[model samples]
Target chain A: AQTVTQSQPEMSVQEAETVTLSCTYDTSESDYYLFWYKQPPSRQMILVIRQEAYKQQNATENRFSVNFQKAAKSFSLKISDSQLGDAAMYFCAYRSGGSEKLVFGKGTKLTVNP
Target chain B: NAGVTQTPKFRVLKTGQSMTLLCAQDMNHEYMYWYRQDPGMGLRLIHYSVGEGTTAKGEVPDGYNVSRLKKQNFLLGLESAAPSQTSVYFCASRTSGGPSSYEQYFGPGTRLTVT
Candidate 1:
């Protein structure tokens, strides 16, 4: 079974500052996908960013980017110039390259202070 | 369009009570999934359907049964609920083919508490 680990249970960052959330996974598959999802108080899961394991280049989406170290089995999300609206529960997820099922991490609660 | 919707947003059940949660998607997606979310534990897949009338067991399927009689509807049943089963359940769907296959649209979720 594949397992995703998010060591940080909770994290906080000042407004306009940057914060990094760490994630690591255990998977034997050579090709896979990594994703970051955000869930606000409304409990709606929203996609943040995604990285393809086969791609050596990291994935970036506007202010959200991922540092994916495939060799280390680590995929971390970095929020640049964070805003209050960025506060939410962040989850790291993995999917087998062609498989549709996703394996998610425990989640990290992020608080953006004004 | 309501991408996906789950009925009985909140439910409370006794240990031996049986109930079913309904999930409907308007996107005509081929893949539908049921997941349970608990504190300190990430969302875990309970069951999923690849297409109409085809269901498959996921990571956690014990004590849970699902049926997909129609393409747009998926039902999850618990014949005998237990306190340990208390958690928030989410329903999601995605396109079968297309670049969007990996992107899952989720419902508002149903909070189920079994006493």
Candidate 2:
């Protein structure tokens, strides 16, 4: 079974500053996918970024990026130039290749202070 | 487009009561999933369907039933609600056929309180 872990339960960053959320996973499969999802108070789960295990290149989406260390089984999300809207609960998720189910971490509640 | 929509944004139920939560997607996705989000448990998949008239158990499927009779709709049912079942429910869908088909679009979750 695949499991995702987010060690930080809460994180805060000053506006315009950069923040990194840590995530680790346990999976035996060599081919899989990693994802970062954001959930605001609006209750919608939005995709932040995605990374495929075979690719060594990290995934970047606008201000969000991921540092995926396949050997360490670590996939961390970095938010650069953070804004107030970045304040939300961020979840790290994993899905094995060709599987429909996603395994998610507990979540990291991020606060962007102005 | 309303990518994915869940019915009854909020609901309060007593123990032993039964109800069905409906999820509809406008994107015509072939895969649909139901997940429950607890305070610290993140989102655990309860049930999922790969296509119409098909359903499968997920990580935590106990006490939950699901149906996908229609191509655009997925229904999750709780036979007997429990306090432990009180949590936010989210529905998601994604394209099934393609190389880059891992992205899932989520719905505005439905909060349920079982007292």
Candidate 3:
């Protein structure tokens, strides 16, 4: 079974600053997928970014980028130019190749203070 | 595109009560999943359907029953609701047959309380 771990339970960042949320996973499969999801107070789960294990270049979405170290089993998300809207419960998830299920981390609550 | 939608944004049930949570998607997806989210315990999959008329147990399926009679709709049933079941439930849908199939779109969750 694959497990994702987010060590930080909560995090805060000043407006316009940069923040990084750490994530690590345990998987024996060489091919898999990693994802970061955001859920606001509204309880809407939104996809932030995704990275494939085969890709050497980390995945990025505008201000959201990831530092994926496959050998270390680490995939961290970096939010540059953080804004108030970035405040949410960020969850790191893992899905093995050809599987439909997702294993998730406990998530880190992010607060962007102005 | 409405993506995915779960009926009854909020629900309350007493012990031993039975209720069904409905999940519908308009993306013509081939897969649908049910998950529960509890504080400090991320989301855990309860059940999922690969396609119409096909369903499988996920990580946690002991207290739940799911049916996917229709390709676009999936239903989860709790025969005897318990206080331990008080949490938010989420529905997700995704297409199969491509590299991007791993992308799953989630619906606005349903908050259920068993008193």
Candidate 4:
């Protein structure tokens, strides 16, 4: 079974600063996908970014970027120029290339201090 | 577009009671999923449907039942609710195959409590 682990239970970052959330996964398959989802107080889950295992270049979306190290099985999300609206619960998820199911980590609560 | 929506934004029930959560998507997606979100547990899949008539159990399917009679709707039912079953439920949908297939759009979530 594939499992995702997010070590940081909570994180805090000042507005306009940068913060990184760590995530690691255990998987035997070579072809897979990684994603980061954010849940705000409204309880709406939003997709932040995603990285394909076969893509050596990490995925970046505006202020959000992922550092994906396949060999280390690490995928960390970096949020730059953080804003108050960025405060939320962030989750790391994994999905195998051939599978439709997604395995998720516990989550990290991100607090953006303004 | 409405994306995905779950009915009964909040509900409370007594032990042994029964209820159903309705999920509807307007994106014409072929894949629909049901998941439960608990504190410190993120979200776990309960059941998923590949198409209109096919349903499959997910990581945490116990104590839950699902039906997909229509292509745009997926229903999750709890025959006998338990206190442990109290959690925020979410519905998601995505295209079966496409460049955006990996993306699963989520609903606002339904908060349920079983006393």
Candidate 5:
């Protein structure tokens, strides 16, 4: 079984600043996918970014980027130039290449301080 | 496109009552999933389907049942609801296999409260 862990329960970042939410996973498979999802007060799950374990180059999407270390089994999401709207509950998820299911972390509540 | 839609956005039921949640997607996805979101727990998969007329149990399928009679729709049913079942239920769908199959599109979610 694969499990994702988000060590930080809550994180706060000032507007225009940068913050990183740490996540780690336990998986025996070498080929898999990692994802970061954002759920605001609206309770809608939005994809922030994703990284393929086989790819060493970090994935960057606009102001969001991920530091994926496959050997360490660590995938962290970094939010830069944070805005108030960026405040949400962030989750880390993992999906094995051979499976259709996704395992998610507990979550990290991100607070953007204006 | 409406993407994905869930019927009965909110519902309240007494313990032992039964209810069904309908999830429909217009993306023609072959794989659909049912998940629950609790206070501290992010999201746990309850059941999923690979295609029409096929369903499989997920991590927390003990108290839930699901059916996928159509490729665009997935239904979750609770024969006897319990307070522990009070949470937000989410529906997701994705391609069966492809470059973008890793991504799952989610619905708005249905909030259910069993007292």
Candidate 6:
């Protein structure tokens, strides 16, 4: 079975600063997909960014980016110039490159201070 | 599009009680999923449907059942609710092709409490 882990239970950062959330997964598959999802107070799960294990280049979406180390099974999300709106519960997810099911890690609660 | 929406945003049930959670999507997505979120745990897939009339079990499918009768609707049912089953439920829809299949649009979850 594949599992994802988020070591940080909670994290806080000042507004306009940068913060990185840690994530690691256990998978034997050579190819898979990784994703970062944010759940705001509204309880809506929004996709932040995603990375493919076969790709060597990291994925970036505006202020949100990911540092994916395929060999280490690490997929970390880095939020740049964080704002109050960035406060949310962030989750790291894994999926087989050819499968539709996604497995997620225990989430990290992020707080952005003004 | 209204995106993905779950009916009965808040529901309370007694032990052994039965209920069904309805999920509807405006997008003509081929994949729909039902997931549960608990404290300290990220969303866990309960059941999913690849297309109309086809359902598959996810990581946790012990106490739940699901159906996808139409292309845009997926239903989750609890035959006997338990306290441990109390959690926020989310419905998501995704396209089932190429690179875009990884992106899932989630609904504002439904909070269910089983006492």
* Chain B: TM-scores of all predictions: 0.98, 0.97, 0.97, 0.98, 0.97, 0.97
What RMSD value applies to candidate 2?
A: 1.0
Each model's chain A TM-score:
0.98, 0.98, 0.99, 0.99, 0.98, 0.98
Candidate 2: residue A12 lDDT (0-100): 99
Q: Which candidate gets the maximum TM-score versus the true structure?
A: 4
| Candidate 6 lDDT score at position A61 | 97
RMSD of 1: 1.0
Better of 2 and 5 by DockQ: 2
What's the i-RMS of each model? 0.9, 0.7, 0.7, 0.7, 0.7, 0.7
Q: Tens digit of lDDT per residue, candidate 6, span A31-64?
A: 8989999999999999999998889999999999
Query: Would you list the rank order by DockQ, best first?
Result: 6, 4, 2, 3, 5, 1
Interface quality of candidate 4 as DockQ: 0.89
Which whole-number lDDT from 0 to 100 does residue B58 have in model 2?
94
Pitting candidate 4 against candidate 6, the one with the higher lDDT is 4
Model 3 CA deviation exceeding 4 Å by range: none
* All candidates: TM-score: 0.97, 0.98, 0.98, 0.99, 0.97, 0.97
Across A1-114, the per-residue lDDT of candidate 2 in tens digits comes to: 788999999999999999999999999999899999999989799989999999999999999999999999999999999999999999999999877789999999999999
The true-versus-predicted C-alpha distance at residue A97 of model 1, in Å, is 2.6
Model 1: per-residue Cα lDDT over B24-88, one tens digit each: 99999999999999988788999999999999998899999999999999999999999989999
DockQ of each: 0.78, 0.87, 0.85, 0.89, 0.80, 0.89
Q: What tens-digit string does per-residue lDDT give for candidate 5 at A1-114?
A: 899999999999999999999999999998899999999999889988999888999999999999988889999999999999999999999988887778999999999999
lDDT of 6 at A11: 99
Docking class of 2: high
Interface RMSD (Å) of model 1?
Answer: 0.9
After the best TM-score superposition of candidate 4, give how far the Cα of residue A37 lies from its true spot, in angstroms. Answer: 0.2
Q: What level of docking quality does candidate 3 show?
A: high
